[model samples]
Target: MGTATHDGAESTAGDEELVVSANARFFRALGDPTRIAIIQLLLARPHTVSELINELDVPQSRVSNHLACLRWCRFVETERKGRQVLYSISDPRIRDLLHLATRMAGDNLEHLAASQRTGPDWL
Candidate 1:
C-alpha cells in the first residue's frame, strides 16, 4: 500500500518505507560528482588526503568534507599508515555498483542532461 507523492513517485508504506528512506540517503551520499571522483580514484588504489587533494585538484577542505560524508555512509574506510591515513572503498562490490551506474547513466545521457527534475543543483 504505497501512495503517490506530488511528483508522482510512489512512497513506500510500513517497514519498506524505512528501507526506501535509507536507500535515498545512500544514493544522496553518492550523488555528488566530487564524491564519485573520489570513489573512482579509490577504486584504483587507496590514497591519503594530501594525495587526493593533489589528484582531484580540489581544495583540501572540499576533499575532506566529501571524504567525511563517504566515511559516514560506510562507502569508504580509512587506515592509518604511520603518520598518513589511507582512504579506500570499504567493499569490493562498490566497483560493480559504480560500473553499472556508469553504463546506465551513459545510456541515458541525453535524458539525464535534459531533465529539470534533477539538475546540477541537486548535488
Candidate 2:
C-alpha cells in the first residue's frame, strides 16, 4: 500500500519521515550562535578545533560540543591531517545558504533589534 509524505504527497512513509527528521536535526544544528560562528569561520577555510577555540574565543568544551552537533547534522565534516582533525563545511550549498541568510539579515538587523526590544506586537 502507498503512504503519505510529510507534505501529503504520495511516497514511502518511512522515507519521508526520515527526511523530515533529518531536516529538523539540520536546523537544530544551525540553531545556535556558537554553531553559526563556527560555520562563519569555516567559510574561509577549514580549521582545527584549537584554531576554532582561539578565533571564536570560546571555551574548548563548548566549541567541541558545537562541532559535534554540526557534525551530527552533516552541516560540517572533518578530515584528519597528520595529528590534527580539520573541520569544514560539508556542502557547497551550506556556504551559499549562509551567505544569503546573512545578507538578508544584515539589511534588516537594526529593524530586527528594534522589533525585539519593543515586543512581538510589531511582528
Off by over 4 Å in 1: 1-13, 110-115, 120-123
Estimated TM-score for each candidate: 0.81, 0.74
The runs of at least 3 residues in candidate 2 whose Cα sits more than 4 Å from the true structure, single-residue gaps closed, are: 1-9, 12-18, 111-123
Question: How high a TM-score does candidate 2 get?
Answer: 0.74
Score residue 84 of candidate 1 by CA lDDT: 95
Model 1: per-residue Cα lDDT over 40-101, one tens digit each: 99999999999999999999999999999999999999999999999999998989998888
Cα-based lDDT at residue 101, candidate 1: 83
Give lDDT tens digits, candidate 2, residues 1-123: 668657787877777788799887677677677999999899889999999999999999999999998898788999999999999998879888877877989978778645654443543
Q: Cα-based RMSD of the predictions, in order?
A: 5.9, 4.7
Candidate 1: global Cα-lDDT? 0.91
